[model samples]
Target chain A: MAKILIVDDDEDFVSAVNLLLKSNGFDVAIANSRQEGMEIFDKDNPDLVLLDVMMDEPDDGFVMAQSLKKKAKNIPILMLTNVGQVTGMDFDKDSEMVPVDDFEQKPIMPNILLEKINQLLGK
Target chain B: MQIIDRQKVNEQIRDLKKKYGDDRSALMPILQDLQEIYEYLPDVVMQETAHSLGIHPVEVEGVASFYSFLRTKEKQGKYVIRLCRTISCDLAGKSNVARQLENEMGIKFGETTKDGKFTLEYTNCLGMCDRGPALMINDRLFAKVDPEKASQIIADCRRDFLKSDFPKVVPSDVKKAGPILDHDLKPAEAIKKALSMSRSEIINTIRESGLKGRGGAGFPTAVKWQLAGAAKGKNKYVVCNADEGEPGTFKDRMLLYEHTDFLLDGMTIGAYAIGASKGFIYLRGEYLYMKKYLEEALENRRSEHLLGKNILGKDGFNFDIRIRMGAGAYVCGEETALIESLEGYRGEPRNRPPFPVDTGFQGNPTIVNNVETFIDSALIIVKGSEWFNIHGTEKSKGMKIFSISGDCERPGIYEFPFGIKVSELLKEVGGEDTKAVQIGGASGHCISQKDFNRTIAFEDIGSGGSIIVFGPDTDMLQVARNFLEFFVEESCGQCTPCRDGNPKLLGGIEMLENGRCSFTYLNELKKLCETIQNASKCGLGQSSPNAFLSIVDNFKPEILGRVPEAD
Candidate 1:
């Protein structure tokens, strides 16, 4: 089983995703802010990470992705954010700036999210 | 009129319409150019402009009358001498210079000399607080003007030989420097970095930096960019609010002169992020000395392919910036009022529901950021978010450039982190014996020594970087009176609360000065301040009573039942 780390400020969303990832037979770890996410990333070292675009600030998730990639270059980051819906902004993954493996808007179907996560883990 | 030339007037109006645009927003620059040619706006020329722009003649008159700089009733002198009368200049012996100027010109402040050589006027904050007793003769700024210097300046104007003795770009007296001041990013480096990223990526980089608007209002900069970028609009605008009219604020004036390339890069980056094709720097008429320099910088950027079509060779990313001259209205510092002024209307703020982000500047998505905010955003694009946000407090998250003046031993610009304590700052500026500190300009609070422990942050006491310190001998009542009078002159009269309420507050201060106010009436006046804050239509009106309320709150014991001054 692959371990996944969830870093988002939305606690209820984190809990729901945690349950979904755990029931799918993956180990789950969670952190709320950028600092906490970094500390947990160093501590837990999850195989894949689920991140949010807007945490304490508007683009915390993207900033954290750059940091995480610097720490572990091959670790997959699945950016799940409603920033497009929230601010009506359209964004996609970029190699240098975003550095995420896959991007999806929020309210995704549970099965698709699971399939995306497993595919990133190469299961 | 002085022999109106019909063909010449028609020709000039046509050329102005072609240079600026046929759009209603082109009204201000057109009128400004015409005013330059006619010495003042003549009735016939205004009529020609009105017919050309398809606006009502009455509306044109309304706009001309609203701004203090515009002259419609009579012709102005060739040299317009505007003396700074705001508190900083007042404390620096501005009245003596005024008296000397009046004597030299043989005219009062609001009069033109008989020979039509000079027009004398008093203006609010020429953005020369650190070098006070400053005056502007036409577009040339003369700082530290004493009575003797005033005589020489008048003599120079008479000889028609007033050469710009000062340097082309006046350097800011930066007492203490930090990262933003020390940013060494070259010209267009940030623009190239931004061009490589997507629109949302550009915004996300700024958002990640946690930069807030440095214009005293702590609105998040990234959020403003994001909203403006996402708003439904075929045409969008990024306006740099360069109207540095606050009483003791002079940092923007320095930034415009010193960091010319940085400001242009920041503005270009903002235009790219928001998909804006056109931009404007609504510079205050006080800083008219810096206009040609800024225009030169814009032209240089265009030549370097950092501003014009396909910026840095990026396809379909065409953007250019123009300089708009503000005709001396302090209220136009407010964004909506700036927009109204941009539209060639009275510089009065509009009601917000469709805010500037959604419907602004001719009903398109427009984002107006402060000069400092734009510069900071551009620097953040190159330096990364962690480098910028690491200095200040968690919420405030950046170093703020302070224009420190008044009662301080070392009065100049200082870049201190946002969460610095008042006492710490006073010590740094050799103003430890400070009695009161006006954190913002006239619209900010007058905090006494008791609040010295408080930090300067958005979560604590946020400021737009105008730190005017008052010593022990300074009169607190007089400070309150000066700020109230500023509001009274600056109020747009669009809303009743600000129009009527401010004069009443000034009257109350006068009563306090004459030792005639009762506690009950003073309480009533406080309530009126609250009413003005609650009922005013815009931010300027709401903040009019801030200095008074803060003074009364902080110095209640000294202010109440105070002995009257000797007549």
Candidate 2:
């Protein structure tokens, strides 16, 4: 089983994602804020990360993605956010500002999320 | 006989440090209190303050010299009379009042009377542009002062019988009120409703309302709240930018008075959404008269458990607010500069990228919204986005409060929706025959007659809600000169283009007045305006040349080829 870390402040969304990952045979760990997310990543060493952009800070997910890339280049980051909808600030994956393996909007369809995860994890 | 009690002064300084805290941020209030005691800040007193605050004496001196309100070398007269010298007042014959004051005082402007009874000085806008030739004597405001009234005021001040001449609170004339202004929303009701909703839900509601900043900038308010909420800080802050020093802008003065509760409600709601435990209302020194009224309002909120810790029975949710006074620096109206003033530093704009949301006061996340913006958001919380959104256009949602002045007959506060046209506004305000209109303040565009059809929206001629109408007889060149002079005086002088280029533009206007300006040189000056706009570090500098450029471009036929006057 590929271990996955779900980092978001929205409890309901986090809970739903946690169940989806677990039932699909992926082990899941949860962290609510950017600081907590980093600590959990170090401790758990998850295979993949489910990141949120606006948590305790607006760009926490992007900052975390950069840090994660620096720490473990092999591990993939899948950004799940409502930042574009919320802020109206158009952004996409770029190596410098928004560094991530793949980006998807929040309330992501379960099958699409699993397919993206499998592709990043080389399933 | 000015007596200096060294021991007593030292003890008082120690007490002030305790009252305000021992950090560098406490320097401004402590100095203000000391100035109140001794009339002027003596070197010995400033040195003692430096020692108490644990900052250097030169650092204290730097701050004292920066603000016009803080005096150092000499004692101010018992009455420090600051007469408004900005555009609207200038148009309202402030010079006549200025001459009358000088004749009555037996001293020129900036000089204190020998007996220390009175001092005359020129200040920027006093937020009374509608009633021009207004002057502030100590903490009291006197508006519509004619030559006769000016002399009488001087006599009254001398006899110490000016008590009955002024009202306790200044009255604002609201000529027209829209749904935003005349709503039946009570005090703290929005806050009560905000408390019921989740934090994200509150932010989402604001985002849905399309509420941009009302402080002239029109930046989206929801983005600011969301960013501040997500920002990593031990403490976060929600600041009410009550520094309404924009030359022709005074709607905030009315909002602070008329919509006091709604303003407080919005601020409390902002604090809750951003997770800010503390907030500050950075009130301008010009609006010193409104301070006590606001302080009392804050006290009411605290007593009712609407403001202070664990508000309304919510555990671990605690928030409080304080009022900080700006010492007559117009640039302090800028968000970062206001934060600097709140931190006891000179009101200079800081470089961007690490914006206020990510890093602000005391290196914490902070949101500084205009007074009207806060009230609008709070109203959104109570009434929902649709109630606020039904009126305005697509991009610019909700109504805006305008402080209309200059040649307009009905000069007062008017609330209009976002997409109202200039011509429509003129007809409503009885300024249909007006030659041009200076939309926004000194930093905004001076619109011509042809562009009256342009709507007041983010997509068009956006305003911070200051409308100055120009009559047919009005001198466009003089109008440009007045705005340039305002920028020259009010610029923080941190950047070269703003500090140097503004005076250069003012000199060019003088040449135009004398008809000595050449066509090639005129074009050169126009380029300089663009350079100043592009090169300056902050908004003040960038927008300083706006009025001048607009007038030069719009009224070319009238401005060019002037006959040489008799020297």
Candidate 3:
């Protein structure tokens, strides 16, 4: 089973994502912040990372992702965000400027998110 | 925290100490050097820095946290894309540009890509107002960017990240009535004339010209010099504040570039008048490309004996200038913050009553003049006070350089005498479809179409010369939000009113933007703004609420629409 680390500030979102991932038979870990996420990443060496774009600060997710990448360059990162509704801008997953392997807007359907995770994990 | 190389950190600290000496002010530069070595300021390094400097860890951390450029943690991507979010850029479709980038990148503002290749963030201003929709990938700037162009630029960067070619900016095509000071005068000619006059004569000439500091404060230049000169201090200093971090303002860049000699000569003359042997030019980091040219100018002057010991071959008249680069802080443009940064501390605004002229830069009497102010001094000395006094209004004498950008056919620098009506300036700049104009970056006033008759003078809507035109299609609420956000990010967090109050204002604006604000909440926000304007310690916090107040005052219907309809 692949080890996935979910780093998000929203407890409800994290719990829902955690339940879905566990039912799919993946070992999961959770962190509430960029600092906590990095600590878990260093200890567990997760195969994939699920990150939120905004937490304590608007750019906290990006800052977290950058630090994670510095430690493990090849680990796939899937970013979660509700920024589209807020800023009224669509996110293009194929954008070279975004270092994420995949992007799922907030309030993601469990099935759709699972499909994205599976595809990114090449399972 | 990562275990940094102890020997290496110590050696670097030693080198920094050697370069800046044991003065407490060197704290900012030392921290900057450490930041460069370590991607982020590590805890171990901070402790080590504190130990080496003989200062407490809290001071180091406080200074580090105060500056936006200084990071305590490692969180930078390979390519950091900073999009300009100032009023002028916003008016010129910066949001569209940001939307394009976000859609292209699969990430919103302030996110690093999964591959660690890119980071998208919002920056205060890149000083490229005329060419709006600007963004910077590291130090290189891309202006006039649309969605398509943003995509193309990203593609090019991905293809060859090292040498991605972008459009080069040409100097402003300024329309002038006649040979102004900058255009007509030869380099060092004014300084030569000042050197011939006694120090009192130089000060009197500047006084008679009715010259004022052009750095937005509009303080009388002659009075500032006279105060510094009279102040009881042996090692008096002259500082030229070239940290033009104000959004939509790039006139200083032009002055530093084309007329380098005049700027240096102005500083030299100021140093001579103030009885100061040492001078410093606090250059902004964004304009690091201009450093080579500035250095060359200084080198030429030194060889010609225009600077350094025994200036102009005269005994007992000695002055030398050194360039100090700012590592990215907008508040450093404030004279006290600039001084604080000069002393190697975080760029925090010092409380007044002992102004910079009396107590500045190593607690010495220092006269901090704007880049233009010094250049103007050189001109007044050469051209005579009577000639200089002919232009401008009764209070604000001589011509001012206006950095006009956004919603104009010709968006560039323009030189005009004070008292020019807003409507006249709009017409001259080709702002045909203009709805509003934001003068003096974020801190300055917002002028509506009805107020276009107001003149540009110290008595009227005075400015440091940043005029950003907004078209009818632009949302004034969004413009106000952008300015509020800028203050929230740039505030040094020294006081509660500024650090906390700005974010509250931003939150209120965001609430309105999202159609969640109530009439009661809006009234509360107005009171909060008043408190911030009246209670904040520095000019930044005081002037921060101006845009929000003006937008609400002028465009009440637009903001009211943000409130949900009465049930």
Candidate 4:
């Protein structure tokens, strides 16, 4: 089973994701804050990460993402956004949506998300 | 995530002052940094800021909490998600957008998800109105959002945590591809148009267009004109409500900045429409830049004979416009309070029946309207009401301007026809992830993804088009607390619920944060929220509890947490 760490302020979503991933034969750990997320990232050796863009703090996820990048440069960062681009910021390079390994919107679809996870994991 | 100490905050302030000079302008960035470090600026932070900079603590505190960037109170959750709910996004179903994030996250507006990982929030105007339903996940903005996109974004963020290391997503270099509106009509031309337009014709034309007020209440522009015009008085006045205190709504600023002449034209049309001789732009003192531009525009018009005893060589529609500054009071936005301020009284709303239209501005018939309402007059005259009607819904005709700010990619002012879907606007603007869209400023509703199909028309948009979008990462609880803090400060201290209840609401949110409040307390507080909305005298009081109410209704579980700890 692939070891995964989940950092998000939305515990319900985290629980659901944990269940979904665990059922799909993956080990999951959850952190509710930017500080905890980063700490866990350093402590636990997870194969992948699921990060929520906005946490209890507005930029918690971004801060964590930056920290993760600083700690390990090659780890894939899948950014989850609930309200997608309210500011109309286009991150796509050459017409393709900017891919930070992978991206997903909120209210996750279990199967679809699992497929993306598998694809990104290359399992 | 950084535990910023006061020393670090002071040092940052000193550095900012050094870089930007000791001028007051340097404080904004310093306060913003403080908010970033502390999540919200505490009272002590303000005092420290003042002590460090050799300024009065009150001044520092005033400036710190005045702008949306400064947060003086603690929020409910560890993570904060501020979603913009303005008109642009409302027409785009920002409520549904917000709701989708709630459902997906298993949270609600102004509530933390059960695990305390996030807090949802609502922001008034993010200044990116053009891209309806904007959101800001931290300092980064993503424009043009929809429900599905919001879910996808959240999922992607979750995936990042699953990885052992933090997500490594570098923001791309931004490219300014769209046309930036940099041109303004010449004062000479604006004056000429203002002079030529006849009073009766302007009224008739506007009446034909079905234009309504852009402010909270959508009153008919033409009927208001006729009443004001018919009122028996020599001391008639035209007052423009430029004191836009509502959060997430800055179309007025855009108009004052980019289309001052149009406002003048509209006011002139209104002046002619209602036979008012003089007009005052009741401008918010916080909008120093907008006031400066408006003053300059007025000066230009006066120099070119567009304001005083004017003649476009044919018709003599003589009128003048003056700018009045508001002393940073939310109550002044109310017509009665605005009038009281002009009369040198404490800014407070008075009893109605002898509405401003009947006995206003020194006991004369007065016409007060929002800046956007006035701007519509010029457009209605230029293009017939039929043309305006073709764009918007039958009841509310014409395109509305929205300041789209928040997590969206493009944060700017957008003009779109009413009834547009929230999802469609997001897709058009390339919003790949949208959590929720807050419509009608902080007082507006929080929409989820399921309601994306809702149209962005007048009846549905709620008030005017101040649309804010949130990315999937937003925490509703923190956002709600932020708005509650605003209410506590912005309240005029008139009614009990609004004045006294504000602190209580803030306290309730705090209790929620401490993990001490009982579920019964929350339920009671929710009831109080409704009572405040129903009994409060003014609009501000009435809508003060909306942020909390929306959260309680939409995201109850998020607010009450899974733990049953009580104080």
| Isolated chain B TM-score per model | 0.97, 0.98, 0.93, 0.67
Selected candidate, larger lDDT, 2 vs 4: 2
Which ranking of candidates, highest lDDT first?
1, 2, 3, 4
Off by over 4 Å in 4: A1-123, B1-198, B310-316, B562-567
Instruction: Give the number of the best model, judged by TM-score.
Output: 2
Q: What is the C-alpha lDDT profile of model 2 across B347-463, one tens digit per residue?
A: 999887568876789778889999999999989999999998998899899999999999988999999999999999999899978999999899999989999999999889889
Kindly list the per-residue Cα lDDT of model 4 for residues B1-567, writing each as its tens digit: 435577876787788667644654345546655665666777767787778767788877655544443456553344455676644455456888899889877887766676655667676544445555666554345556689867765665566432211132212212221111222334345335544555545665676777878886777787677556644566779999988877776667666765677778778767766667788988874453355557788888777666777434445556788776664566778898888766544566776656687577766789999988877776666656786777678777777766566667776567766667888866655555887777777777777677667777667756575667777767777777767877886787768888898899889888877777788888889889888998788788888887788766666667778326654
TM-score of 3: 0.78
Error of 2 at B308 (Å): 1.0
Residue pairs in clash, model 1: none
Alpha-carbon lDDT of model 2: 0.88
Please provide, for model 3 over B1-567, each residue's C-alpha lDDT reduced to its tens digit, 9 standing for 90 to 100.
356798888898999989877667677768777776776688778888889889998888987877666678665666778888877777778888999898888998878887767888887777778778788886677878898989987887677554423333336546544335346778889988998887756877887898988999998898677656645567889998999988889888778877778888899998888789998889887765566678788898999999988898778888988778787789999999999989878888998756777688888889999998988888889889988789899988888998998887788889989888999999998997799998888898888888999999999999998998888887888788888888888898888988998899899988898999988888888899899989988889899889888888888888898898743
Using Cα atoms with residue i matched to residue i, what is each candidate's TM-score against the true structure? Answer: 0.84, 0.85, 0.78, 0.56
At residue A79, give the lDDT of candidate 2.
Answer: 91
Model 1 lDDT, residue B558, Cα: 74
Runs of candidate 3 exceeding 4 Å displacement: A1-123, B1-3, B100-108, B113-116, B159-161, B164-170, B173-182, B564-567
lDDT of 3: 0.81
> Candidate 2, which segments miss by more than 4 Å at Cα?
A1-123, B1-3, B563-567
Interface RMSD of 2: 10.0
Question: Which CAPRI quality tier does the interface of model 4 achieve?
Answer: incorrect
Per-residue lDDT over A5-116 for candidate 2, one digit per residue giving the tens place of the 0 to 100 score:
9999999999998999899999999999988999999999999998999786566676688678878988899999876566444445666445688988877899999999
In candidate 3 the C-alpha lDDT for residue A50 amounts to: 95
